[model samples]
Target: MKRKGLRHILLPLLTAVMMLVVSACGSSSNAGTNGATGSGSGTEAASGASQEPASQTASGGTGNGEPVKVVWWHSMGGELGKVAAQLVQDFNASQSEIQVEEVYQGSYDESLNKMKASMDSKSGPSLIQVYEIGSRYMIDSGAITPVQQFIDAEGYDVSSLEPNIAGYYTFDGKQYSMPFNTSNPILYYNKTLFKEAGLDPENPPKTFQEIKDAALAINKTGKTGASFAIYGWFMEQFFANQGKDYVNNGNGRSGLATESMLNSEAGVKTLTWWKDLVDSKAAINLGRKTDDTKKAFLAGQIGMTLDSTASLRGIVDGAGTNFEVGTAFLPKADAADKGGVIIGGASLWILNNKPEEEQKAAWEFIKFLAKPETQAYWHINTGYFPITTKAYEDQRVIDNMAKYPQFKTAVDQLHATELTTATQGAVMGVFPEARQLAETAIEEAFGGKDPKAALDTAAQAITDKIATYNKTVNP
Candidate 1:
């Protein structure tokens, strides 16, 4: 699973941060927003004894020669970190031309912050894993090489990748990064609760009205019908579900985003629906943390909740005979809404500052990760669906699919999505801060403020932040 952190550090602080980084000697780790845990000791063990110099080789070596050393910085920790470490071990065992040292650089925020601090120095890793929202900042940083260059040079057929997943990383007709772990949100319902409430367990709610009705029925059973986390990510998903852009400039795909459309008709409607559910006691406000809602669902306190597919493994195991878990596509704002979800999770980016040979070696590791067999292992072990379409055909994936049929809902939802700007998701340098503002709006609405008024205030704040971001980046 993934996590969010305060990553919108101003440029002026880099000098001080860089100095501190140079003197810093210990590893740090933090839990992610996606329900994954990490240990500082595990981070130290994953990264190894000490950091390596950037220019370890005088020349790019290949095929039995001195191997090219490629350093990889990542945010995955705990069990996910172990899986990542195993993959690196497998890759190193598979080839002698490249050696990859996997480093666990805390959370997504810490990893990106370190990257920024190490930009002008040689302490940065050759390849880094950055979360989905960091795409805009990564591009604007101009310190990394676009994976498209390697793709074109090697004539790599990207057709094997899931289109919707790849669509998120593509900007200005170029693929900036190679998608690694990919996930989408889905509605997880308690099957036993549905049966108890006389709702059809097989036929889950698909629209706002249907969910509200289901929630009411489930509430009649003396349990909360739903407890949707007041997450900013879900707010964005609702806009996409209604075929509405969260920002202008084609959801920031066509060009730099200059405004926030969180106050659009779709946004107001979505918020009002959610508010109505809370007011009617059909659902409860669970604040901004998804973890709380997940716990509530597993404990049978809530009938349904919204969360990433990355949370499937833990949710299933946590339920463990207490209740049956049923998964469905995220509900649409209206029955006729045409858009779908945006992909979550991080992607792999190669640093331009690295030696060309090291970059090439890093590409090899990326290619290995994208292979069907590897992806299947990743999917089964980490709960993140594969980015490669062929991974679904692998026997392991097939077996795992049967074991947990609920997982297929996320896959179906992803494939069913239309590749539109809104569904592809919005991109902005100020996205992290914007999400916080969006969450604040949700809290205000739940606090009895008018939904439209709350959204308008948040949207204006995001617009001002966007303008400020544009000026600083483009100045």
Candidate 2:
């Protein structure tokens, strides 16, 4: 459900924008013009604050004994934004050598675009949060300093971090960023509706055929069976669930991906099954927004739906006093499918243009955020599971899990996932645009176009974009 804004801009235009932004950085009036929009009360200091140059110090402190300042740009909004702001407040209060100012940029796409436009300027943040799909682009941009350098220099023990979550950010045996918020898709169903439809409430559908059968049964009860949003992420997850790669070159882990495998047999099977459900009146094709489908499910208009684990808190609260909400692992294309879910959400990256002291300070803040206590608070407050496994042992997290057993399903599903290239996720510089193309393909298939034909066209378009991106980065 991440909102990716704007289409892909060529690298030439991006370079020109960077030059313009850097030239404008000399103006004092434009110091913090690129700061946060009003999203959190705790981030008042980050909105239009003047930028001051820092002097080198042995302990990452300013020349006048002031704390080193670190600016963080993020895309978390609403309740999540509040939680992020609270984290920043806690970190700033807990330390004296470093101070953090958080700015809530727009969605993931907007934040990444802003970073591209400002990376060469003084207005760019020392630390920024980018979505999972932006990993390849960020790595290729040559504007980031890999967090692995800090881990190695400080001898930090990373064994506590969830491997499956960290795997997405790791490249060439090196960790590029610190995983902040991680989630996976899950099946949410109304237990009351399942009972009314005479389906087993506890035994939710485990495979595509079973889901179809359950949906047909629910529809026979004069209610809609399900409504799945036409999300491209789900399509990627389905490929992983079937132990299939979305792109070649080891899911783009070993090397740059030259093509997309979106039209493979796995892809055709998944879309055909989904389109069949809609055609047979077993499911509704809710457009591109998962929000619309969430509303329908909460209103008891649909029996089951698919959504990220991050939505568990909001969904459960919305369904309160109405019906019991049952959570299950994401359905697979076949009963024997051995693949599992890929992690969603975003991670924190350190920009290379910042001074060494500021980068070190940003690393300190990142370490504080990864602590078990902090992760537990984040997990309970927002439905995102903790990236650190030790967070599960915290009393608060334990109690929260016991109270809302649905949350445990996500953790269990993550632990059950098999670590492989497919599950680690595909990487490409043009992933944002690729997702939009995938969504278009889904819409076309729903409009009566053959699933394979639609996927082939979309896959080719993604391949072309990948080639263009590769040339831009390599040339």
Candidate 3:
């Protein structure tokens, strides 16, 4: 695909975030409590007990033999869940050979855990959405048929897939999974607060120093200054923007990552900068939870923050018409740095044990979800950057961009990022645990510990964790 426009940059950043989530498993057998609830308003129940079960597909269509029912387990809920349901409805209505039943499997971790249990019992869904961090473990588990296998066997035209986004999932010329919901981090600021503080509302901070300057001004107005969740994903972004790797072996793109490099000079510099910001009262210690910091932003308690682009809709709805919200590229550590941000969000994988017909039916549904029209609909409804290169040209997407100019800023920033290994993201087997350690290290730094000491402790801990994980998977 020809790379053009701000939309082009999303693929690389998207790949990075997907490469950071780790694997999950559960012992639960009950689907209802395993985070399987119905989509949105009608079926928000915990067990995800659907009104339309597999029987509907068996009885609904003709001439295509019995319509095959393909179960899709996903982690989306709330507003995003509504959009997912609509996509399934449209796909089901557009054809008769397949019927997709989307089961809400809680958060990414919860869904993967249930999926692992289901696989062990040989009753897993036809397709499962796994976060990027779990990619290494997923490949090691030998549970799913690589989407690349299907693509190659069917001679599928995957040219429509965004390269940087697709690149993250690709290893040894094989795309392991299909890119689905994708996003990047951005700096969100309250324009009204900026103006109140006599800072230029139009010019948001472009670097950490500028953020500190803006935060100091905003704090003088008696409002909380900038704040962010102590998230490993954002820290990964900070590292990527500095052209630094999160883990060894080409950020785990080239080979198995056995250790973390987050305690190096780059890591110390980034963490120390964050620590100084906190010490000067220019940034808030919003703790480790992302939701807490998001609330702080939406409640107008804080003037600026760094968060995923996915939060755009919620911030819009929560802040209402009383104040204007603005978004910019996540402020760089250095203004002249060539590094770019990484993308966050998950992707879809097809399971291996399903019957041939069932597998094909699942692929059909997956391909349908990748269409430009479908991507545009999803993008407009959920704030996730569309995965298809052409989706941006769709009228709906164009209209939405015009309506919310802040959304366009994300596209521009994404296009500005150059693709590189660091920006491609890290793929560690114990990435989830590693991320927690990173977050904990940041929290320690925020609490006034020496940044290098805190990071060194976390780095050493991850190295030990990786060694143990490698034994189990590689043993």
User: Which candidate number maximizes TM-score?
Assistant: 1
Query: Model 2: per-residue lDDT, tens digit, 303-375?
Result: 9999888777678878998999999999998888899999987899998778888999999889888988888
Candidate 3, RMSD to the unseen true structure: 8.5
Model 1, range 1-475, lDDT digits (tens) per residue? Answer: 0111212333434334322332231121112332132111122212112121111122224766788899999988777788888888877777678889999997676787788877667689999998778788777766678899989997999998999999999987899999987788899999999999999999999999999999999998999999988777888889988889999999999889999999999899999999999999999987766767888999999999998788776788789999999999999987877889888778999987777888898888888888878888778887787999998988878887897889989899999999899988899977766777887898899999999999999999989877866765665
Model 3 C-alpha lDDT per residue in residues 292-369, reported as the tens digit of each score: 776788888899987667667667667788789989898888988888877667788888767777877888888788
**Cα lDDT listed for each candidate:** 0.80, 0.80, 0.74
Question: Which 10 residues in a row give candidate 3 its minimum summed lDDT?
Answer: 37-46
Clashes of each: 2, 0, 10
Q: Candidate 2: lDDT over CA atoms?
A: 0.80
Where is model 1 poorest over a 10-residue stretch in terms of lDDT?
Answer: 47-56
lDDT of 3 at 79: 57
Evaluation by TM-score, superior candidate among 1 and 3: 1
Ranking by TM-score: 1, 2, 3
Question: After aligning candidate 2 to the native by TM-score, how far in Å is the CA of 216 from where it should be?
Answer: 0.7
lDDT of 3 at 428: 78
TM-scores for every candidate against the unseen true structure: 0.89, 0.89, 0.86
